[model samples]
Target: MGLIGDYRRLMRAGIALARHDVILPGAYQTRLPLPARIAGRVLRIFGGGARGRPGERLARALEKLGPAYIKLGQFLATRPDVFGAEVTQDLGRLKDKLPPFSMKAARAALAEEFGEADAARLFAELSDPVAAASIAQVHKMSLPEGERAVKILRPGIEHKLMVELSAMKRAARTIEGISAESQRLKPVAFTETIAAAMMRETDLRLEAGGADEMHEISHKSGHFVIPSVDWDRTGRRVLTIDWIDGISLTDPKALDRPGIDRKKLANDITQGFLTHAIEYGVFHADMHEGNLIITPEGKVALVDFGIIGRIGMVERRFLAEILWGFLKRDYLRVAEVHFEAGYVPASQSVGEFAQALRSIGEPVHGKPAEEVSMGRVLLQLFDYTHTFGMSLRPELVLLQKTMVQVEGVARAIDPSHNIWVASEPVVGSWIRRSFGPEGAAKLVAGNVKEITNRLKRLPEVMDRFEASLEPPAPPPPPPRRFAPWWGWFGFVAILVALGIWAAK
Candidate 1:
């Protein structure tokens, strides 16, 4: 019954998508089955409104489906390799804008997160929601000196998302069963990845912690801004932070903002994102222009900490070197990095792979940042998988997505922004510092410390081994039979006779 209900809901959502010409339209129309093609035509005839751009149509269809579906679209946007660039870009454009729930529901959620007494003390005045998304809503709260942005999760979001996810899982299973080719795509694993990310966002504490950590990291760079979290006022469902008033990076008017340094803003955003990812190993994964703001004082402020990404030292080094190689027009090094990182199989020729990379890098190298087609670069890189049998690394998906979005934001602010130059100050210095002699010494010291610790525990391990080797008590001797004594006497007599004969 539960599955039936979910399937019904999914069908309704599909109909809505078809009616909106999201599923069967433009280039994708050719791939549809005959039945779907006929239905799609009929729906288009009845649907009076002109179809929008592919991305816009997808956004609308996702919006109509519900909050969880909206989130699914956003999650899919990060996977350009699985979905083509056009569809993923459209998914990326899908806004999380949804109508706010009732004020009473908001109050109830806040009260649940914080005890009634604490809730009253923390919040002085709770205004209507100023902004709402698929998962949560934001409201202005009165404070002593300034206002606070209080974010509260929508009621029953977890249950809704779980149901939607189950449907997705079923669909993934069906696809895997139907098509052998789809197995390489790992549809089930992709669905699971989206589910985990969505589930994590439901927890406000983790989100708050991400913001606090980002703030600490950003403070060091002196090029970024992060608002303070009010721990006293924050709760599991509600997160409270100091309000920030700044121009959104998406705003066209930001270009003309008086006293705002657009070029510096562009450099800071690009460099700051890379530094955070490479140097600190943590970054905001969902960094669209909407999540970015330019302060009145010209600082680049980062907000909406729900989705963050982390990478290990090895991945960071690979990313930095790869970007650096492309920037330097060293396609061979770029290809080498991919092979070293096991992105491309060893069977593939390094020289041939380098030549393939050159095709991808040459167009964008040394070009103005705004003019370089990042989408094309990503698409071309994706195309290499067919030639070299390379698969996309799941761990780097968020990083790649964020990098693309960051470049778009930066270029929007400054047209002639040189990605290489903007990135060199942070990425170049990091490479030289991390891969140099001092870096080698640090790496060796870390390994030595680990070995020394293991050696110190060897004595204890030896003692345990010796204790295990100690044998248990021997079993009592078997009782002798009466015949054994007679046999022994005969043997003694025979021995005496033999000894006497030898003596003679």
Candidate 2:
């Protein structure tokens, strides 16, 4: 039941999708091939009256499937270019919420992580779970210093997730092998990325470290709030952080509070993400409304740092230039950056790519902020990736996904929120600092230092080169050795004794 087991799990998933009318969805039936159309008609009969758009039905199916599928759906929601806006919007609603494990089970997990006596001593006033999600749940506990939230991993989620993810990987491999067109999407790599992120989410220690790091970044940026980690009470399965006493942005009533600046909050959400990514090269990868808390002071507090997006200096420059180009409506510069970043194949024509970029950017410009959709623009840009022979960048997937989430949350807070406008300050400042005269000076200084360092090592490198050029001395003749006469006599004696025994 190795490969067979994967196929069996996939079969079950297929049936679920068929029941939800996601297999050969009705909207595309007319466009499907004759055989596919016939198959779709037959499948719809077993759909159990699944209603809503295909994405909505698929979301229900994935949610019903469990945590792994839910995570996949969330990942797909980030790719509106592949699925379209309406479908992705429906999928975006796939939340991580799940019923909480029992209080007894929660206590047991804590005791197992920290011995029973220590668990009681630390969490004497531990309350019932305040919130629950697919991978873990949070419980509020009181400490002498302050109230803290204790997050515990689900009892047996790791194994369940591993089984489901293995099936998903098999399915991805099957899809890539069967369909040439799917190769550009990199389904195998995509699934692996999601699987890796899901596995990381199970380890609360990593999450604690992420929280602490982001807290420091937040202090410097003053853009968002991050909870302080309680190191003394934390463990691999348990993360203790200062409990945030605020309303989650997920609540419909969250924005209705007095003193809340909806417009400013929206801008802050957009700008905060850009500032973190462009300036610091790290950001909370999961920026969904559920994970964002609007404190009483109206500051956005990010929690559940199970996923964090990071980029190297090269990617940061690529992102900054792209954003800056878009802000200035210089589609050519944007296209050039893509080429320079090696995202677009060298065989592709730069002018043609620039034209495609223009198509995506010009429409959004001069339009009312509420009328424009950053997600839609990204969708078109992703579409161009295929047209321009650009492959999916695994490293940028999380960053792209988080960008969409940030835009969605920001737009929800204020419909008139203009991300491009918000981005200009951060992106523009970064571009100026990175590509201007000051940047040129730093580049020259760096090159000079590099050359000086190499010059210093020249003598050592030359010595090694000369040493290799010289011939090696011949190996010493095999060590001379001689058996003593007594040794030879003993061998003969042994042979004679053997001969006598044989004669007897």
Candidate 3:
């Protein structure tokens, strides 16, 4: 009955999606079998068709399906490789905002995280929630003389997500059974990724910690701004953060108001994003217009630390070299990065991949800034990589999506903004610093420190190794084969008696 109910709900949601007016008029009309059409018709009979722009319709359908679906749509929106640009754009506008929890619920959460009495003493004022989302909401508050924003986790979000995600997994499995394309996507794996990210977002403490780490990393980098956390008022379900005042990066006109240099703003946005990506190896995974703001001093202010991506040192260096190669118009070097990073299978010739890359890079090399679209380059590369049996890497896919968004944001501010120009200086400096003489010294120091630590633990390691090598005592013998002679005879007798009784 539980499985049946879940299947029924999922079917109903599918019908709702089919009827959604924004599904490109005939989204499900792809020469499917008569039975499939009949099933779709049955679904339409249960609900009205979608209405609104394609993207807007998607958002609406997802919202109706529930929080888990909305989140799934959001994740897909970040993958331009999966969904086309139009759909991705629509999903990008799908905000996670939902109604805020009640004061009673919020208080309960606070009490659960930090004793109610302690929470009361920590804040001078506990205002109502000012904003809400799928995982949590923000409340305007005061803490000792400073104004702050308090994010409180929505009550029971974890339970809701788990239930819905289980249904989603089941649905994904059913879809895979019906569609071979879905099999290649590894829907189960993708669902797990979504589930893990959702789980992390539900923990307010983790996000608060992420914000603090980002803030500390950027404290000396004047180009970036991450709000400070008020630790005293922070807890498991609640986060207290310093408030930031800035214009939304999406608002170019407002950004231009009062002498905001569009060029400089564009540079700062691009450089700040890459700096985080290459230098710190951590970057804001969600780079929509909403998460970025431009302060009065023209510094870019980043908010919402729920989603971030990490690339190891090797991958970062490889990415830097790829970007450098592309900028230098060295298709061979760019191809080499893909092979070296194991993005391309060694079985494929570097020369052939370089030729494919040249097809993607050549057309855009001398094009005007406005004429060249990074999206095209990315799409071409994605399609080209498939010829060499290079499967998509979700992390890299996320990075590409982010690059698209960041590039779009920068261009909106300055129509002719050259992304390559902004990236060159930052990427060049990072490369030099990473491989320069000083960097070599730092590397040597790190190796020496590691060696010292290992030497200190040498005795303990040897003792453990010796202990592992010592043979264990022999196991007790099996209990005389479980007296199989009698047990088997009795089992066979019962089966024979049952068969005879059935025949009779």
Candidate 4:
């Protein structure tokens, strides 16, 4: 976007925050330099003199800023340790509900996904949306097979998200350039991560793919349930899935139906995600109560696969061993896992790190899920990572976030739900499948098979290596100073790099 556009957006965000009374007060903002302190005072004065709860004000301000800001707020809600309880709780409200756009817009998106006649023929009835979220609104529909849930992307959502994210990118760049500490925190990379996710979410097909993959893995586990996507009737801008007949796990009275086992369901949801992540390496990342349902059969049905987390074989093993260490109260082993995963720098002493891990893990070893706060643990972990000069493990952050969310859901389902106790069975099974004698034999066999394949390709591999070892072709004569556009490309690239360095 143009500079004018970004300036306008920044101004609007500032104005909204101020009008809604969302300034950070006390030592936090006052600790800055004199100029910053004065700016803080001005903001506080404009922020309605702290007339309301800061968290609620913040949430309202984000809502006023539009869908992208609301999304940022919802993401922050997942990090209670970072944002504090009041703001997190208020932000939680954003995830459960959002004002619906026009019905006409929904129909237009539906017709665009499928031809008007075809869509009309496929969905016998398109009831009003039962739930609305930032990116999409879901309508209850009837198909020949049965009742289905149809999710339609908001109109012009791609453009809106892109515009907002562009402004955020500029701010992230400015921060990264101004402060080495901010650069170390990876503000730009972090913003890029969020922007990438929002972009991927604009395309409904990716979410459908995630649902299919999750169902495949979760089905193999045979405990949790996932809604079946209606493949034939789904499209890039729309998703149609079997309507789940279950109560929201968030509502205890509605969830506590005859034949339902609340505690078991809680265990299933927690174990389901844990086992799926380890066993298949792919699992749903978004598991808040609204995305979870307890069917009449007492099975946990997973839905809303817009976000998912994946762990590679190495990372999966690393996670399993880390959790196993904590389960056993072995801080040394957890520290070893971090080093082996190359998360902690090799230069750091394992002994000191283990001591630190002990401090973080000691409080939770014997506690139930509801009593233990992994958010607190995560915060401490972040502190240790920074102190040790360790780079943040991007691959595991999603898993960490999902773990917090899953724990919250489990606790809500049964206040006394013990995550460590509930996860023992699944973790034990994974350990056996990954490290037992049979698992070792299987691993060796797989390695041998891979070696055999590589041997078959040995000739081709050598050919490429030998070809690369050959000297490069003689360089062409240098172009004139006023050469063709293509000839100046290298010089232009160097200038761009120089500009970036100077900006930094």
Best by lDDT: 2
Give per-model TM-scores: 0.84, 0.84, 0.82, 0.84
**Candidate 2 structure, TM-score to reference:** 0.84
For candidate 2, what is the lDDT? 0.82
Instruction: Determine the backbone clash count of candidate 3.
Output: 4
Candidate 1: list runs displaced more than 4 Å.
24-53, 449-504
Q: Where does candidate 4 clash, by residue pair?
A: none
List lDDT for all candidates, in order.
0.79, 0.82, 0.76, 0.75
Q: What global local distance difference test value does model 1 have?
A: 0.79
Output the worst ten-in-a-row residue range by lDDT, candidate 4.
Answer: 494-503
Model 1, residue 173: C-alpha shift (Å): 2.0
Q: Which residue ranges in model 4 land beyond 4 Å of their true spot?
A: 20-25, 51-57, 75-93, 368-370, 445-504
Q: Candidate 2 on 73-135: residue-level lDDT in tens?
A: 977876665677667778878867899999999999989999999998888999999999888
For model 3, residues 1-504, the per-residue Cα lDDT tens digits are: 268767656555554565564322346546554444444444434335445666778788787776788888989887766666667767877767787779988888888888868866775487988778877888887655677888888888888888777778776665555555557778878888888887787777898888988898788565588999888778777888987777986566787587788888788888988988888888887877888888777788888888777787778888899988988899999999899888989999999999998888889887899888777788777676558988656777777778888888888888988888889999999879988998788778878998999999999999999998999889888533323335335433433333233223
Question: For residue 289, what is the lDDT in candidate 4?
Answer: 77
Winner of 3 and 4 under lDDT: 3
Poorest lDDT segment (10 consecutive residues) of candidate 1:
494-503
lDDT digits (tens) for residues 12-69 of candidate 1: 6656665566645645658754544554555555344547777677778888888878
